[model samples]
Target: MYRVWGFITNYSLLLILGAVIALIWANVDSHSYHTFVEFPIAEHFFIGEMHEGHRMLTLHYLVNDLLMALFFAIAAKEVWEAVILKQGSLRGKKAATPLVATAGGMLGPIAVYLVLAMILGSDTFDAVKNGWAVPTATDIAFSYLVGRVVFGAGHPAVRFLLLLAIADDAAGLVILAIFYPTGDLAVQWLLLSIAAAVAVFVLANWLPRKLDKGRELRPNSTWVRNTLGFWPYLIAGCISWYGFMRAGIHPALGLLPIVPTIPHADRAFGIFAEAEKHLTDLLNDIEHKLKTPVEVILFFFGLLNAGVEFNAIGDPTWLVLAGLIIGKPLGILLMGAFAAHVLRLGLPEGMRTSDLFVIGCVAAIGFTVSLFIAAVAFEPDAMLGDTPVQAAAKMGALFSFGAAIISIVMGKLFGVKKVEG
Candidate 1:
């Protein structure tokens, strides 16, 4: 039993377990699963006398809006450290090729989606066109798992894919912000969200030191610059999350603005990179504390969100599959090759273009964030009431399972072998 717990906890096996359970449960008794997901957490409530704006919370809403905010917070911190802080392979001109390749990853899917949508022109395709961003996301956890399988634990191509996924996530955040908003836009709340993020940044990085003075303190003290010492971050996170929620955007994105502000050691080189040992970066500390909670949250996330009825599959399904499996890899390869020739860039040592090709295949797995985008892109309302376009988008997300198989096969074809730890 202890060994089982250790294995599942070690490599995000719990997350996979959760997704598999959800799929099987939903398929076996979809009505029960659906009812549970939509089950209200609280009774309906109203502020004004007319009860004009009453609201009720549901399980799905809580998981996606609230818990996933932490997930995005972790993602935002990593991206900030990598791209802006020059951590990981995103540092110098030598890193320029991968950065460009990241752009290709985004543009390629979008371009393929558009062309396919145009060719398959109809009212049906037009209705679901907003889902173009769905195929663009790379589930950082699953992609990392597949890459580890394909290229061992420490291959440079795996590092390259990690950086690529981070950059892809940054791009996805932008796309979500710009393209997907709920209801009429609230400018005041948007500004408030920005203010909250800035305040969090300042509180996390500056206030602790000002309060601490120059006194030498034990490193283990909660009052010292550790996780507990940074209580203000939790406050700031909540405020920012509320701000985005009210501003009619996905609240998961609330974490992005505050990440760069957290004090951190300089970014490290390579995948699975570590921060400076002796020095404490508050963001790094927060990430460490969040490790287990994030895993738990991801399990629930997969459980609640991955439940898709087969009837939801529609015209949008094929388009999404094509973009993820075909466009994603092609885009990565073409962009990397372009940069290598035009700008005279080279792959990380012992890495080759063929290895990149396999890495690109791994890039095709999209879930979590992709499902979130699908939900956002096909929100139910008058024009599309009770339709399955949203369901089809989700079906495509589920189809990303095929991308994993493709990666493994392509890895073998390219001579990749499992490395013993």
Candidate 2:
């Protein structure tokens, strides 16, 4: 079974599975299930031995707010590596297609939403305006997985689409930061950002000093034998997250300052490349131990919370879901095909117009980013309580899932295959 999907198995499907379980649990009449989602988990730990330790702590926080920040950070890592260091980096004209798609996808949703708002009148239609920007996205991890499965290596066009999808995600993140950050921006928090930037720069300079003599950062020569490369940055990331949290900027925003300094091999020379390979291995181990757990735990608990009752799917929510799941695919495919044809950019390799439509359908798996948008959509001071907007977002994600299923069916019916680059 794992062989069938490969690692696409993770990402959104895992979260979606949890949600389905929650819905099923909701439909059931079991009282035992109530305690899990309802009862909050309050856990904390000491950093040192009983003699000298500080309490690292937690409480009833929103999963989307904190843990998902880490996901954003991790997702940011992938996109950053691409745009900054990888071949996919879009400087100037290279960014055209994804940039176009990003703008259109986001704006289209707002247009649809505003039309709904006007039809329903401001009060009713505007309830989820924060979510207006929700649909302008394509989840990269999931999209890459889907592309790998449906589009083989021969398909350069589809492969490019996958890259475009990832690039679009990065753009979406920027959009979220610019348009979606709630309320007045805080100066002191921005100051903390500057401080964090300074601290990371200081750390990067100190990396070589911590190394041994006769050893350069090049391959076969390792500078991190002294624990300077990975552990220090990982701990810094934790501290950075905490500080950003307290400083009132979204904690995930703090990740931007620390990455330029992650100590990946900078020298393109051969000896340095070998040493860089070894250092990279060490860094990977460290990231797995430190960062991966942060992301994983956050996801698990987030899922546990989602263990809430799902049977309550009502008319308003279901309709919103329908719009997201159904409307999004239709809107994206029609728009994308027109763009491709009008511009004379060919279809992704091994892909046809039908395939692009299917890809658009699957793009709506809006689990991660959509969830974040939902959490922020309603004003904390609003009347219907903390959840109406959240419910709408969840519905939209569900609708997206449904649309993806339809896309898969369509693809199978039409025979979408991998085309060589």
Candidate 3:
């Protein structure tokens, strides 16, 4: 429990603080808040949002586009380890039902969001249709915290929730990369990102180990590890980021290619396990080193992205909320039950079928990533009547905290028995 609270405090508390400040500031003085958010840090910068004829770096752009890459890289690292490691959580028969449920979690939101939009009339549907991916996000940190509260530390549903959230994140990344482009696609620039990944993997990682293969001392690999450390990868990451920016993909995902290139432990202790911090592999080392910086990045991310005015609440807002609150549980319940019973994959021991709905309620708290998706989903100028669609959609993401209460209530109503550690 202490570990879970600590993780939340370290990663989420600051973000909440930032969000509270932004909400207060935006409501009190929206004009000033907007000015501050768009304040230019640099004009005609080599890397930033294109303004007029040249790139200009704003505080919002700095936090959202540049620094946020670290946050996503951390996410990518967990996903990579979960998929690649020998004892990974996302492997074998144990993960089949949860993986299938993850698919439903995502698909359900899209179906609900789009269907509701269409019902609201074609104009509203066309205005907000692109934002379908916003509600599919399951903020891993907040959802995990809420899950523990509802299900207790010993519940199998808690682990199942974490698995679903992680898989949702992996899928969310793919959605962002494929469905949302920052600019006109320039396919050729992606070659630079690929080249950087391959070069770093070979020159910094593969070669050193290859040279020390037969040697007991492993002097060459040791030299690289001790002397050079993370520099090579950092340089490669910068190159990849540039490539992503030029290639019109979200730059925040640039570090993804580099994450797999880093040396990692052969076995993972799971994302929330305390044992993970003790791992000395380069991947873990980089993640630990990045913890503080990523926390700060997330703080600004929340502040910059979550400043929708209270009046901005409109159709898109209800649409996003409906998708998360209504769609998530039903989707998970039906799909998870099918996978467990129909497919014969089965739920984890001690977890009842009814618990799947409760887990879905917990997973519906899509605060962070949902906010990000909303920001990228619509143009700043895009509007539904007088309300900005992006701002309204972001408001829905913020309101997803309501799902925490819904999860707790559903947990009790469904007669879920808490299993304490």
Candidate 4:
């Protein structure tokens, strides 16, 4: 319980605070709130939103496009560690069911969102179609907190839920990169990102190790680690970010190409594991250093993104909610059961099939990433019957908190017994 509270305070509380403030401010005085969000810091800046004939750096752009990259980088680090480390949770047959379940989790929301949009009529479908990815997000920190409350720490379902959430994050990143381009695509610029990654990996990571291969002290590697520290990777990350921005990819994901270029620990203790704080590897060190800043970035992120006027609620809102509340649980149950029973990928010991539905319910709280996807999925100016489609979709994401109550109720109704570690 202490750990759960700690994690929430560290990662979630500030975000919630920011969101609450935004909601109140927007409702109280929408013009002032929006003005603050779009306040221009600089014009003709190297990295900013394109406006008129020049680039303009706005408060919103700074938080969303630049600082948010660090947040996504941290997420990429966890995903990388989960896939690459020797004791990775996502490795081997142990992850088969969860991985398959993850697919269902994403597919189900997409299916639900699109089908409902179609049913609403083609004009509505065309307007809201791009936001299909919004409901597929599972806010990992909140979901884990809710999961612990519902199933206790020791429940196999808790671990299963974590695995599914992590996998869902990985998939979400891929979707963001591929489907949510920020501007007109320019494939050639991606070469710069690739070059930056390879150059840094070789010069800073691989070369030092290669030089110190036969040395007992590993002098060269130690020198690079101590003397150079994170500078090379930082420089590479900036270049990669510029590359991604020029390539029309969302710059928030730009740091991804650089995360893997940095050295990491041989094993991971999983995301949110207390043991991870003790690891001194460069990757973990960087993550630790960025933790507080990322928290603040998330605060600003929530502040800028979650400010939907209550009256903005419309078709997109209900569609996103339906996708999460209805689609997520059914998808997880059906696909999870199919994987466990039909595909011969067995559920973790002590995890009942019924637990999958509850995990799905918990996973339905897609606040953070869902808000981000909503922001990008539609133009801010896009409207549906006087309601901003983005705001309506964001309201749905915000309302996903309702899933927490639904999960607890379902847990009780399903006879899910708590298991304390």
Candidate 5:
């Protein structure tokens, strides 16, 4: 998996290239657009007949529920590895670059969005305007490509930037689950879901000790056996996610159980024990099976869901673009620098405060999640003018990506090239 990931990182351009090709094909091929809705599960089944949309496993649903679970789980695994398991293993110096930069990058965008929301909240335009926060997203693959590989891996700053970017993504997922999910939920489903969560919680707390069965006392039990002690928790988490979905909440919320509820490390191994040797391996297998088809499903939706049939980028387009491109970097850099200083967590070795200004600029390259929020935030056809919110989101991401690149080049002239120790 590490080799495969490295390969993916090394040739990220090709993955993107493939995505672009798929996107084009999806838009052009009518059959491709319906791919996500095609997977069948069931509805009101008496243990026999198949259902299409009801109990069916659609493409979009699978991507959000199953694949993204692994995505979040894997991310959790990475955070565990970086800060704890691999702590200071890197040449006897722990890397604070990503952890610091990511916090600043994330908080900055959220701050900008909140301020905008407050100011815009008084009017009906608030509905449309509240989405400015949507653009603060930083795509990890793109950011990693630009920061680490494109910028050169030798730069310690780039590695930190990548970590920060991933952390930023984790933050975004939290915000989305909290702020973006639909408020109107089916109460019965909600109750059932809660009931399930409680059940899982009880089982997790009780079952682990039962499974331990004096295993911890045995010498040379091996970490492998400790993992075997965790199956009940894993099973419980799966049940939690399924229940959450039935309860009218986003199923992504289900992955939450896998963390706090599941015991990744034994008392002896401690929480900081790197699960990479085992946990990542399990997640890697799940990720391999899940990511490909989910990607395909989202591509299908992107094509058919392109409701911008008659829209064109216009005046308001320029306004949103300005917010994302101009607003994102300035907000993130200022907040990040302030926090770092206040917290006594200084910048990376020889990296000046000004370099983050460019990093801040790059952070606004928000397309994927922005489009997601736009899809949920706006009604079927509420926004006025030629461009729909969906189109605006795509456009905003493009503008931000373009502007971030420009900022990167321009920052070199004004930013300190090297900092004196």
Candidate 6:
């Protein structure tokens, strides 16, 4: 029993369990679930008052908008450490393939979604058209889980999938920040956000130097460096998040700009040259510290957001389903193949060209970020002004579960053996 508990807690079983409970609760008593999520925690009206004084936020808003910022931050850390801080990240032919594959993975789904939506020629398709970015996200956790089962824990294919997912996530972040907005752009607020990000960068660089000044005074104490390092980053991150929110952008993107500002230790290999390091860069310390809390956040995230009504299914559902399960793999494979031929890039050791398909299939599991994009894409009070359209896009996100199952089956068919480590 202890071993079982350890395994579940260690491997994000709590998060999966939370999602399951959400689905069941949503199906069994959706009104109660909706009420729970909508229940307001607090509210505040500014002295001048805009939009009813920012009404603190419901449980749903808190989870999706605020808490998810950390999730995006963690992902951003991975991308920054790999593509930016790492040596030889963009210089080599070996690094070029996955970068190209990431591009294909993103564009492929958008193309599939647009083409299918155009062919459908329905008013509903037109209403939810912004949802093209929904399926473009690849959920790293679920895909990695599937990949471990199919390719063994140490397979190069699994590593390839991780890199692909990371790159896809970076693409998704750009889409979320650029494509979705709650209102007209507030240029001043956007500039403020940029300033806040720069402030974070400056602080990140400056704090280490300041702490070093005290290091000689308290030669034996690690406390000075550790305590000062974290709080300033947190404060700066909060300022940055607020700037994005006021800028009329999704606050989740707030973390991206600031991530590159965080100090990263120099590394010798390309981003994909070594295995995905769980804890290598100093900039990643924030993500490492928040690992367990992030899991909890993801739990509530799933609970609050995964409760879409199945009856809301529409043409967007099929479009999303096809775009993810079919479009993701097709795009990744084709683009990867193209890069290999055009650039003379090669696959990772022990990974074949055929393995790319299975990797793509596993990459199709677009659960968390996909749902977040769906929420933004078919947001309420948008120009369309159709509540059902939002629900329909969410249904598309919910349907991504089918894609997970298909990936597992596809892996087996593609001869990816489950070798125990």
Go through the candidates in order and give each one's C-alpha lDDT: 0.74, 0.52, 0.90, 0.91, 0.51, 0.73
lDDT winner between 1 and 2, please give it: 1
Q: How do the residues 329-369 of candidate 2 rate in per-residue lDDT, one tens digit apiece?
A: 56656666666677655454445676655666556566556
| TM-scores, each model vs. reference | 0.85, 0.74, 0.97, 0.97, 0.68, 0.85
Better of 2 and 6 by lDDT: 6
lDDT of 5 by residue, 243-281 (tens): 656544567666654554433332112112233335433
Residue lDDT tens for model 4, 153-229: 99999999999999999999999999999988987888999999999999999999999998999999999999999
Clashes within 3 Å, all models in order: 0, 13, 0, 0, 6, 1
Best by lDDT: 4
Q: How accurate is candidate 2 locally (lDDT)?
A: 0.52
lDDT of 1 by residue, 1-421 (tens): 0122333354356666777888788778887877777778885663333236766577777888788888788777767767666545467875677788887777788888778888887775678788989989988767877788788776777768877888888889899887897555675887876787777655555665666566576333335454555576677777777778777777778766667766677654433443232346676777778878888887887787777667777778888888888888888988987887777787777787777678778998987678779878887532222247877788888788789899999998989765533
lDDT of 3: 0.90
RMSD of 4: 2.1
Q: What's the CA RMSD for each of the models? A: 4.3, 6.9, 2.1, 2.1, 6.8, 4.5
Candidate 1 structure lDDT: 0.74
Q: Write the per-residue lDDT of candidate 3 for residues 109-146, one digit (tens) a residue.
A: 88999999999999999999999999999999999989
lDDT of 6 by residue, 5-102 (tens): 33335435666677778778877987787778777788755322456556556777787888889878877776776676545344355567888988
The better-scoring model by TM-score among 1 and 4 is 4
Please tell me which model should have the higher lDDT, number 3 or number 4: 4
